[model samples]
Target: MIDLNQSDKRQLLFDAARELFLEQGFKKTNVAAITERANVAVGTFYKYFASKEQIFYEVYQAENEKAKRKIVARIDADQSPKEVVKQFLQEIIRTSEQNAILAEWYRNTEASQVLMNYNQECDVQKNSFVYRFLLDNIERWRSSGQFRRDIDANTILALFNVLVLLDNHKEEIGHEHFPQVLELLAEMIIDGLTASS
Candidate 1:
């Protein structure tokens, strides 16, 4: 029942939305602008996405996939578990800042919370890049004795989740002190997760 031409039109809209979001951000972008840029009829966008938010969510996912590939490729197998954990935390901040859509979510706490709540409701954490990355590497680290044998990947995930929570509250925690706090916590998490030499 799907028209072959439908995909091309949808992709055009998707690409145009991404370009516009990156250039002017979510608040400034309009659905009309997206359709204009995509060279599609204004009504055609409604056939693909319910709203600007829906299209932005699609763009966000695509951008995250790109980031995950880069992050996975950059991680060295030779690094110890501690360094890997630190790098993982650092990459969270780096990738978010690098992507405009991702940064917008952080800047708007209510929107960020809504997105996080939706993820929780859908139980998508298992399919997330960070979860899968930690799960895969945790297994390898445990086998190679780089990580504590008794500790499960979930513990590490919880720690990382806490770090994310702290980062979200950085404004209340004092922007000037957040870096020091994050550094201390990362060190503690690394020390906790690593096996003794």
Candidate 2:
């Protein structure tokens, strides 16, 4: 099912590009550097990607896939929906911190434009996976009168957007306050979706 040669070459480019991007940055790193680092001919690089932007796009895609995998693994452990949600936020924050290139990319580059375009072209499911996962798992709570029946599953997706904003403001809140901040936001969301006791 997998094209070994194509996959290996693509990964070679991605790994090399990611290293260079991390070291010198996107604007500073040229295709020649990437090709040399990848031990591939310049033509070989072009065979897999149209431009440096395209290569970075693949790199970011792989990063997102890794993030999703981490999220899935962190959530799969036995935990309450609320606990899982907390860990999910923690995982994202941890991942972003671990991937300094991602933070730097978000801060210095209008890289979101390329990322958005890539998502539009490839991710038909978009943000639905996260939203649906939360909604399905939380439904039992709703049935047990622990959550509000009126809250839409999409509301959880919207909450994810807020979490992103909060995570991005790590300095303002500081890492020491992350758990409280996340819990507060989660509580606010839960309150909005649950009947008042």
Candidate 3:
């Protein structure tokens, strides 16, 4: 018997489901598998989540929150704009490489579909801490004359999103080259955002 408190059981299920979803993706992962991995009864899954999709979305949100905390904690006003951008990109790449399960999910079509559905069902734009953080950083840089004032935060953020997607393609790009590619990407972003004379 899993003698855990309500919160502990919920966290156990969440962690198990997240790992399974990342490893096998949303389409292949089922409630039974999740419960079994969590050491809980199959029926107990319904007590926490309506479906596998629900648990996946919650897991996604939790992961995003964790990433946000890490990013925010690393921020420093003393750092140069380019340095900050490099740090952000490096952190993202490092996190993805360290978590093979997440990397697998990013390369899986079913996981992408699940993420799309979850984004559509949730207030993704408004609730995304990453987007909000990028927007704020862009505004700060522009005000401080560290970044080009011509490009709006939304456009810069869109470019950043593209870079993030590219980062997810490490297998195709070759693991050894991925870090160099990210460095080049960071340089390009910095060049584009640099204030013109």
Query: Which residue pairs show collisions in model 2?
Result: none
Would you list the C-alpha lDDT of every candidate in the order shown? 0.77, 0.70, 0.76
**Tens-digit per-residue lDDT, 1-197, candidate 2:** 53459889987888999999778766788899998998888998888889988887777666766676768766863565567777776676667666845654345435655655665687535554555566566766666766666765566556656865564565568667876787789867866766554
Runs off by more than 4 Å, candidate 1: 1-4, 110-114, 174-180, 195-197
| TM-score against truth, every candidate | 0.82, 0.69, 0.71
* Clash counts for all predictions: 0, 0, 0
As a whole number from 0 to 100, the lDDT of residue 124 in candidate 1 is 62
What clash pairs does model 1 have? none
Off by over 4 Å in 3: 1-12, 18-29, 37-50, 106-113, 120-123, 165-179
Which stretches of candidate 2 lie above 4 Å from their native place?
A: 1-5, 76-80, 120-132, 158-184
Q: Which of candidates 1 and 3 reaches a greater TM-score?
A: 1
Output candidate 2 Cα RMSD.
4.7
lDDT of 1 by residue, 48-110 (tens): 998887787778777877887788778875788777766766776678878887777667665
